[model samples]
Target: MVEIDGMRLVQTRAILNYIAAKHDLYGKNLKERALIDMYVEGTTDLMGTIRVHHKSPPKEKENNLSLIIERATKRYFPVYEKVLKDNGQHFLLGSQLTWADVQLTETILMAEEKEPTILSQFPLLQAFKARICDVPTIKKFLQPGSQRKPPPDEKFVATANRVFNRK
Candidate 1:
């Protein structure tokens, strides 16, 4: 396995684009391809925002997380909901699994653990998350050691849960 210690565009968005190209997830035409790009970038931005907030200081983590979550809901949730509403009950691109769905699901699941109430505002995104979790490929990838909860960190998770009334 090749080790990656730092950032690489080739290893990030480009890698996803390459996979999409290989699997033909870019859709059947130019317009559809544009939609795919929209979803991919939206998903990437949401995840990147969460990552930044996740690494912030504890005293300010809640504020950072709140900003990130708020921005995501405001900026991208509607787009995702619209895509799912227009396309079908499968992926942002519909029926077939795409890297966009994979990345979006991962980010949502991680965010859910922190702010479980976040997806409640967007029912379609919630369903999208559930479907992604149900996939064998994603389910297996997310199994066991794939995602480690932030070691309790009750101060943050618990407080957020209480404020949001998340189970």
Candidate 2:
């Protein structure tokens, strides 16, 4: 939860929506907003899998990782791929960047840390991840000296920098 000017925001989705609204990342129209919400919820589901995997026993980590990768590949990535293909855009919701795009990027980063090859099968998803990371503000924020919660692996950082065209 976060408190700003005496107002408190709780719940992951609620906080994300609030931030998106404040930053004008929620999309323009009602339909677009609904699409964004859909994708955000999808990402949240992927995050749930990640959380379970994180808390699982070491012996079970491999199985959990396999499950995560399978779900990401068979379930999540294809849906996003179709959305991108149908929209003919780099982002999840047409030509505009939405909070869903941000959430997907985060999901990709986490998945990459756990399974580096998880994105290889989905070219469009890979490109989408790169595009989100390529945004100027996001690129800057992801640079070497910037802080990242939980501190991403050095290899992941290098890969992200390369993908984003950042030094």
Candidate 3:
């Protein structure tokens, strides 16, 4: 949720669309906007898998995490890879960045936190994530100590760094 002045916003997609509209990130035309919406929905579905992993019981969490990772890596990510392949662009919808790209980046980050090597098999998607992270604003936002969440597990971070060749 977001609060601006005296008004508040709820719902992830609604808030993202509102912000995208205000910032002209929705798209240049109706068809582009529709494409962005389609990708945003796809990202949301991916987020649902993360949510399930996070909410599973202690006894079930490990199994659930494995399943979530499998589904995300094997199923959802291929769809994104194909989209990027077909679009032939770094961004999801077109030549420019959109809310969908931003949402997908967040989903990728979440997945990486859980399974650091997840993107190794999907080079296009890996590059797509890197392209988004390379944006000036996003780079600054991702700098060390900038996020509120605790640091990722050391093992995961090490694995991710090794797989992605990050320092």
Candidate 4:
């Protein structure tokens, strides 16, 4: 939840959209928003898969990992790979960065957290990672000690399960 001036924002996508619009990252118009929304939805699905890993039974972790790798490699990555290859732009949509680009960058990073060499088969995506990482704000955030949270670990999972009362 995000609170500003006592107004609260709940729901992840609502906060994302609010921030994206505030920063002019959503898109220039309706058509661009439609595309951004679609791609972001795909990334959200991919992220949801990864999120589920945190909730999996200990014995299921390996299977969860394999499933995550499979979905990212076979289903999701190929779509962005094709988009970046066909677009020939530094970002997904065009020259300027959009929410779609950010979401794609985020999903790529999350997938790589599971498999460091995940992009080996996608040369274009490797290039995209390099380019996105070089962006000033992103570069700073990538530095050690930044507020960026790494993928949840055992401790985080434990706390989340306890706090949320998950089985």
Candidate 5:
């Protein structure tokens, strides 16, 4: 849950929509929103696989990593690569930077942790990653002392299990 002006907000979509509306990151039209939602949802799918990877047992870690790389390369990266290639735009929805761009950049970076050259086959995605990382705000967040959360470690899994009573 997130607290804004002392009122509590629950659910990920509510929190994200609040932020997107406040920052004007939702795009300017219905069509743009539809496209942005499509890209964002794709990344959301990748995030679920990544969560399984971090929470997997040590014995299965290597296999989980392989799955992440495979899904990312086969299912996700190609869509973004084609979008960037065909649109020839700075962001997923075109010239303007929307929430989808931020989400894609984040997923790309997380996937690279498993395989540094994950974008090696997708030149347009490589370029997109570079461009997105160079954005002023994003560049700042990438700095060492920033609030960017690191990949989930063993401790994170333990905490989640403890707090949620999961295995």
Candidate 6:
């Protein structure tokens, strides 16, 4: 477990990577493992940028969101798609599960649920999100009300609601 800003954050990606390595998910070579690294790094960059933008003030975020999504989809989404296109028997990397697959799937779903139109231009990405949600672990994590909203982020939410037209 890791603590970030007093939040007990677990290193999910590290755990998944360890599991994949132990389970022989990577192809039997260094190059194959490198490919998984590429996928994880790229996806992490995309999601991290999005997370930053999500927590930004609406005024700052409004214009940035489009650019953020555009760049993420153009760069990150296709990488995952190509990975899946080659190794997408079940997950982003392959029939075996990996951290890249889990992270990308969750990021895409959270994006779609919050802003459905962002990835509409990429059906493959949309399908990737759907496939992710269909996975047993992910499905369980996303079960109805399995997670709660961020306690309304009271101060921020109230300010944002007032800034926007939300009644």
Winner on TM-score (1 vs 5): 5
lDDT per residue for candidate 2 within 1-167, as digits (tens), equals 89855779898777878888888999898888898888888988998898777655567879998999999999998898899999885788778888889889989888887888999988998898889999998898878777766634557656876798766
What tens digits encode model 3's per-residue C-alpha lDDT throughout 58-151?
A: 6787998888788888889999999999888578875888888988898999888878998988999899999999999988888888863643
Better of 1 and 3 by TM-score: 3
lDDT of 4 by residue, 1-167 (tens): 89954679999889888889889999899988988999999999999999898778899999998999999889998988998877774788867688788788888888889889888888888888889889899899989999888999888888988999987
Candidate 5 wrong stretches, greater than 4 Å: 5-7
The residue-by-residue lDDT of candidate 5 on 1-167, one tens digit each, is 99986779999877886788679999887888888889999999998898788888889999999999999999899989989877765788768888889999999988887789889999888888889899999999999989998898899888988899887
Candidate 2 Cα RMSD (Å): 8.6
lDDT of 1 at 137: 71
As a TM-score, model 3 comes out at 0.82
Local error of candidate 2 at 142, Å?
A: 2.0
Estimate, for each residue in 1-167, the C-alpha lDDT of model 6 and write its tens digit.
75544566468766556667766765467876787787777777777776666666768777767767777678777666666677654676567566567667766765664467877776677777777778787788787788634323548766876799664
Query: What are the TM-scores, per candidate, against the unseen true structure?
Result: 0.74, 0.84, 0.82, 0.92, 0.91, 0.70
Off by over 4 Å in 3: 5-7, 148-167
Q: After superposition, how far is residue 117 of candidate 2 from its true place, in Å?
A: 1.1
Give residue 50's lDDT in candidate 6 (0 to 100): 67
lDDT of 1 by residue, 70-150 (tens): 887787777788889998867877787766787778778767766878877898888888888988877877778765445
Using TM-score, give the best candidate's number: 4
Question: Runs in model 4 with CA error above 4 Å?
Answer: 4-7
Return the lDDT, model 3, position 56. Answer: 50
Q: Which ten residues in a row have the lowest lDDT in candidate 6?
A: 148-157
The parts of candidate 6 lying over 4 Å away from their true place are: 2-16, 22-29, 88-90, 147-167
lDDT of 5 at 45: 94
